[model samples]
Target: MKNWAVISTWSMSYDGLLKASSMLQNGESAGDAVENLIKKVESYPLYKSVGYGGLPNEDGVVQMDAAFMNGDTLAQGSVAAIENVKHAVSVARKLSLNKTNSFLVGEGATKFAMQNGFEMTNMLTERAKTIWQNKVKEQFKTGLHPYDGHDTVGAVTLDQAESMSAATSTSGLFMKKDGRIGDSPLSGSGFYADSHIGAATATGLGEDIMKGCLSYEIVRRMAKGQSPQDACDTALYPFCEDLKQRYGQVGEISLIALNRKGEWGVATNVEFPFCVANEKQKAQILMANPGKNQKTQIEPISQSWLDDYQKQINAPVE
Candidate 1:
């Protein structure tokens, strides 16, 4: 059996990772596996940071961003602030085949999806709308900042043939500005892949993530002979410290990587949970946090943590 593997950000991506792992095991293309992984997250109603049930902007509109990259050809496609698309990642995958105009934004992206016969839906569910309504009330009464939650579903896949791909999708920060877009749809920052090297993806505060271009940096480090774990740590930790000094305060930043050799690694400043699966290991969710001396400490996720997450996501809106 040829080597195959997949790694994705967040516990929300575990189910998608499982499906993608099966696809990879069946000798599917990396592009297909990565796209399918992201689409699953986009369609899950309980994941508030992505796709159909994503929370809305300050104006109560659920705008989404997504991107797809093909490592062999270094081709990329992206959409930003798009509305009413059932699977934004699918739209991005379709655009990756185009040579020009591959990145679209706002109404243009939405129109392209509609014209291309992609499934169209409101994107916002009643639950999300209710959450947005309550957020609006709270922000109005307390004058608090509404910028919270930008957990993008990012993934990297390596197929049996050694090909690789990277993709990302997110509804962006809840109660964000009407036209705001995050690193989720931006290459280098949100995702990067290369068949000769490796693949990487990032999730966190898009603003800071974009500044570091952590995904591409990790791949570059891997190309220079660093292992996946070292590449992730070397690329992420120093940047966090530098950003704190230069930009004042840093935000939540997390990254996941998979080398062509089927090795995987992750780095994060926050308590991030991610999913991974390869030929030798079953799909599992793991926790990652910053460690001493600029290293990352990773551990198996506890059953209690999983149970609590399930309850939190399924809890009723008040």
Candidate 2:
């Protein structure tokens, strides 16, 4: 009667190491696999928004970061402000598994990428550059830029019975320094998962991500008998309250969770908000994105659904 599922911080990644692993309900052979898939996806260029998609800068060049973790081992791999190199997560994974240190940043991570044979490139887009140029001309003191919700991606998964892993990748805030880094690649802060309390992941608004350790907080809440919606809602409630007190700026958080007994739930700050692909259910799997306006309808998983999911958790995907 155990449960397992994957929750990505953002929905845009198609080649996330953990995303690929979750789709197959496959347990990785080693910790390195988490980054391997992330790197492999970087070659396509289109997925750049997730793994290689440079975060749009005020001036419109790409800056990126990534991180990977194995819940079973609590081992961490991280890289910040790395440029051009795809599969940033893989580079970090190698560092964590092969080195004494748990993190690598900026030029250091890029060097590790080269040492490991990861090729570098100029990860810029014509459209994004044009937008930045336009912002510069608007005569505004603060140039405008777009949020690459598409560029940022994170992954969390609890495979079969009890294996959990999380991976995250992103282009940093647009118009940032040539070497700016965001929370996406920060362990525990951006995206984190632990096998002990099911799994959790987050996306959107990184600087404030540290405010409450959002994803992990939801996991702990779910562990304490809160439904997925309850856990996610509770997490967001405080975030909203704190914003009023701190900077008067409201923020959003997204989450998906699976409990130990084969039930699942999702919460977000928008509508038509998220998607899910399960071992048994793969077609048209989008779920509601939590919204600030309404109470998320909480439904109990029928015994049959729970039983079926339990089987899915333990059985290898076809």
Q: Note the residue pairs that clash in candidate 1.
A: none
TM-score of each: 0.99, 0.76
Measured with C-alpha atoms, the lDDT of residue 263 in candidate 2 is: 48
Please, what are the lDDT tens digits per residue for candidate 2 over residues 64-120? 777777777777778887766756777766766855766777777777788879867
Can you tell me which runs of candidate 2 are displaced by over 4 Å?
1-4, 9-11, 14-48, 138-151, 259-262, 283-287, 291-294, 297-318
Which candidate number would show the highest lDDT if scored against the true structure? Answer: 1
Worst 10 residues of 1 by lDDT: 139-148
Worst 10-residue lDDT window, candidate 2:
9-18
lDDT (Cα) of model 1 = 0.95
lDDT of 1 by residue, 180-293 (tens): 999989999999999999999999999999999999999999999999999999999999889999999999999999999999999999999999999999999999999999
The TM-score obtained by model 2 is 0.76
